[model samples]
Target: MQAMENGGDLPRRIGVYTVERELGAGGMGTVYLARSRGGRAVAVKVARPELAADPHFRARFRAEVEAARRVGGFHTAPVVDADPDAQAPWLATAYIPGPTLAELIERQGTMNKEQLRSLGAALAEALQAVHACGLVHRDLKPGNIIMADDGPRVLDFGIARAVESTRLTATGAAFGTPGYLAPEQAQGDEVGAAADVFALGAVLVAAAGGSAFGTGTPMGLMYRSVHEPADLSALPGELRSLVASCLSKDPAGRPTPETLLGSLGPDPNPSPDPKTLALATADRPHVAPPVPVEPPADHGRVDEPLRRAPAELSRTPRVMILLIAAAAVASALVGGFLALTRHGDDNKGGGPSVTASDSRRATSQASTPPSTPASSRVAAAPKDRVTVVVTAKSGRSWISAKDHNGQILFDGVLDNGETKNFTDKSQITLVLGDASLLQLVVNGKEVPNDFQPGQVERLTYDRSGEMY
Candidate 1:
């Protein structure tokens, strides 16, 4: 299960989705609740920056995403998008609309015999689909199961092997939750489909009652899984036999998901109502994080004035000082008279006379050109500047952007996490080499577009206009 964390610093855009916030992070990477360009909500799982550097890890992660994509079953969260070769490889899946089984059990207590039966059947069916795709859901603990409206749905199938093979076992230790790992997995043996069945059995025990092996240190749990018999006394009378068969020490003795479904008979409950499930799974009330306090601005360092005091005033004799003051006064009077004459001539006809304007222009050209006025400089600065942040997630993509006036702002290759922010007035248009490789953000909102891999796209957006 991914550990929940405050997602305060999570990027506003990842891939093509706008990240709402982080849901959690495990040994693998952070999971974010994000929305697609088409307004579809999805759970985006991103690999950690460090892990993305490992070539072996990237290969395994890509394989996991591909394998998960091939599995077709209503019982699993379907992969909506993915880019494993990205700087921070990520996968997006349809957001399940319910709480995890673990959360459900924690809040409402264990499921009754009937609920357990339904859950067992659904998960087994999901496993069948996974195995058929030549993959194994290495991590199938209660946390990975969501009790959706229709039934239980499995999640996090993408990159399961990457997490198991790289992050968790980096210290030469085994991966997976100790209590839920199959005996074969704990023994460091190569796993097969039956390994998932063993995990399902453990899940059943928790659903029917609680952890069968109880709690202990990692080593203790590993010891019990390999040597001790599971304490299954709390399991309901009817499910004990089937659950035990699944928890058998030998993998061959375990029942496949299909066989387990048959053993459970039939689904007894109608699909849960979507509205009810949504309400039940609504985010729990949480204390809003305290607003950060900003440091006070420094006001002591003032800019030096451009003009300097006349040094001659301090050193000149008293007589010379009076002479200098008189001379300065005379010069100011003459300058003011000249300014009045120019202004009167300029306003003779309620507008500047052509001769006056020409004379002013000639004077201006005769001296060094006046510095650009602050007002004019501000106008010259970009306006309606739509900041477009483009990040490359996979292979290199040709990225070019233009302002509403058709002026190109950016033209270059972008690859995995490589980002460029552009500013323009009115609107911005983007031309992408491959839709899937580029994630777009204009101003602060994510641009919605489902550009297929290797497909070129030309999209335009404005401050007030929707992306097109």
Candidate 2:
């Protein structure tokens, strides 16, 4: 049911539970922290009044309760209470004390190999539970996973209408985060386990420290999910194909969540005691496996911020390359953002391309560029930050321009198949293939982007419509 008021907090005690605090709000409702009569902490979700009046929504919620009830996994937050018939129907589940995975990724850019492997394993395990029960967690995204001390826990089942439910979903009703949604879901195909896997693929990109779908706003990502090839350029080699398997558009081509876990190595970060972690963080903490990351043992890896650079700068496949060569010779500050990861800057700038090592070097080295000479500062305010984007498909990298914020200054590919940077704040978004997300790099550090561009490099895909 919808909250009685728009943008207003929900009322306490819908029936027997008491609302404690507002957790979050959505277009249809607000999620709250509440307590049941048994003194258990519960996450109570109340719908907006408008939605409550819709019989279709009510039927969906009623069936959702049953579908969610079938879920059984250590990685899932168990549902404990509900009142599908209340005037403002609501469902309550045990309160999961932790920040969402989305929160953790924003705080810490991509996870090193070990962390990615750990995440893949845990999430795969969680999905296995969901799949086994014959229930699909239609909504799976970074924001949906809670990083508890134990492991990543999946949440939110309100939008999940059981397949067996006789009630039809409201016309044009679509659920789940845009970038993370599968292609089939976008096309309004009846979904099942595969849809969730596609979402898992996007989630992994985010977990590994890349944008969910390159760049652009949430809406842009949704558009990309529907029509473009995925940008998995930042993905580590061992796991890239694994993620690809999950993203397969053909439902039969994708792996069951359980099968997905089989591809990842064992978990290195042992789950900690939730009680102890809760005591330490005070507030609900969304825990990560720990950072200053180390890659998995199979791969020769070292500290993340201090590791040796990859052999080549990561690149999008194709004849399209960014004018990195031209940019390097023209300006001292080629990339954007701050935080040096390497020693003295590479003034020569003539580095090898296509290798991950070089990309690492660029990130590490440019990250530590020496102070800018006072003479050249004024002429290039817009070019103050350089952005680099890598993509899964092939493409000729290009450059455009954007203002200080994320507004588009220009849009086109500047170069093809090479490493480069820009100083202009005309925020450059690397468009990989015909995708919605523009692989974005602000001043160098990987950052999320809206559709508004600075400048952008075009990505070319060897193949397209990659999902299956």
Q: Give the number of the best model, judged by lDDT.
A: 1
What does candidate 1 score in Cα RMSD to the true structure? Answer: 30.1
lDDT of 1 by residue, 1-468 (tens): 222255546677877788887787765778999999999999998877767777777888888888888988979999989987777888899998788998898899988767788788889999999999989887788888888989999987645567655423221122566677764455444577777888898898888766756664443354345434566666666677788788766666678888998888664544566676666656744533234343332112211111212232122111011111222534332111000011111111132433443333211001111232212222333435655666665655545555665443443344344555555666766645455676676666665646554443446666653563
lDDT of each: 0.61, 0.53
Compose the digit string of candidate 2's lDDT tens values, residues 1-468.
Answer: 334445665574566777777888653457888877778888887766656676767787787787778787789888887777788777777888998998988886668767888888888888888778767777787877899998889887435442212111221123455567664454333466777888888888888766545554333454345433465666776677778777654556677766767667664444556766667776645654333343342212111211112212212221122333224655564443221111111212221232322243222112223243222322333433343433212333223232233233222332222232334323332222222233433333333433222121222111111111
Which regions of candidate 2 are displaced past 4 Å?
Answer: 1-10, 162-173, 217-219, 267-468
In order, how many clashes per candidate? 1, 70
lDDT of 2 at 214: 52
Residue pairs with colliding backbones in model 1 are 37-448
Whole-model lDDT for model 2 versus the true structure?
0.53
